[model samples]
Target: MLQSFYLILCILGFVLPYSQFVPFLLEHGLDIKLFFEQLFANRISGFFGMDVAVSSLVLWTFVFWEGTRLKMRYLWVYVVCNLLVGVSFGLPLFLLIRQRQVEQQTD
Candidate 1:
């Protein structure tokens, strides 16, 4: 059930953002400067960006260390998902995968 929930969230994460970004890109033609301008346009936006940036660093570090410690495959998968997808998607997805791995060990 949790896995299903996370999967749903993951799917929505991609779907919802692509819904906007695709259209924006189509209209803007890969406007990197405008992207950053909008991203850090205000203090609130900058705060959120900083929040995500810090959390991403933390998440990547955890994924790397924990993955190696557990000898887990698909470590890169988590990293890529975190980078390419949002943390809203990646963290829940990672939790789901980690839960399954732990359950397997207990069994």
Candidate 2:
């Protein structure tokens, strides 16, 4: 049941953010150079992107530390998913995996 909760969180996370990002990509032509150009075009964009970068770095650091300490399986899965999608999807996915590990240890 707890795992289900995390899975639901992951699904919502992806759905909510992509609802915005997908439209942007469609409108912007999915060009990598154009994406980066616009990502830093304004002060707000710069601040927001940098903030996300810093936060993602912090999150990954904690992920590595805790995952290593607990010998968590599929640690790379979280990292890869974070890169491919976004933190919204990856964080909850990692939490779900971590929760499963905790449950296993108790069993």
Candidate 3:
């Protein structure tokens, strides 16, 4: 049940963010300067940008520590996903994998 929940979250995470991002990509075609300009266009946007930046760091740290402790392979995959998408995509995906690993260990 938890695994199923996590899977659902992962799907939502990827889809929800990409729903916003894909349009930008289609319109701008990887305009890094414009991206940053818009990302921090105002205080509110800057707040979100900073929040995500810090959250990404936290996620990376947790992924490294817990994943290594559990001897989980493909740790870099989570980091890459986080970079390409966001914490929304990375966190639940990591949790899903971590859940499976835990289940296997217990079994």
Candidate 4:
């Protein structure tokens, strides 16, 4: 289900930071300073923006999923915590999960 998908995505997120991409960069003798500068100057904004979007989606999905199992009070707390997690990790998946739950209720 969505939960499983979320977990898998989280695992991938963790793995990506140290995966072949980093090794490939290192192998190419890329300069860390220049590379970082380029990343920040040209890519970090877009990259992190995507991260935020994705995190929001996942978070809202999780919230909605959890709402199905619990009372509103608990669900609200769950949503707040999920939002905090998303903010901390720059991921929107959790927020997205919650938004889905709200949409379900309204439907």
Best by lDDT: 3
Regions of model 4 farther than 4 Å from truth: 1-41, 74-86, 89-107
For residues 1-107, could you state the per-residue lDDT of candidate 3 as single tens digits? 99999999999999999999899999999999999999999999999999999999999999999999999999999999999999999999999999999999999
Instruction: Give lDDT tens digits, candidate 4, residues 1-107.
Output: 66556656655554654473477577766576754555467576659757766866766665566655633345455446444343333233443455456667789
Every model's TM-score: 0.84, 0.83, 0.98, 0.33
lDDT of 3: 0.98
Tens digit of lDDT per residue, candidate 1, span 9-91?
87887787678778878999889999889889999999988898898888888878877776678887887887776676677
- As a TM-score, model 2 comes out at 0.83
Which ten contiguous residues of candidate 2 have the minimum total lDDT?
77-86
CA lDDT, every model vs. true structure? 0.80, 0.83, 0.98, 0.54
**TM-score head-to-head 1 vs 4, winner:** 1
Q: For residues 1-107, what per-residue lDDT tens digits would candidate 2 score against the true structure?
A: 98999999999878987897798888987788987888899999999888867867876887898888878976788877777677888888888888888888889
TM-score for predicted model 1 compared with the true structure? 0.84
What is the C-alpha local distance difference test score of candidate 4? 0.54
Which residue runs of candidate 1 sit more than 4 Å off their true CA positions? none
Between candidates 2 and 4, the lDDT winner: 2
Supply every candidate's count of residue pairs whose N, Cα or C atoms clash at under 3 angstroms: 0, 0, 0, 29
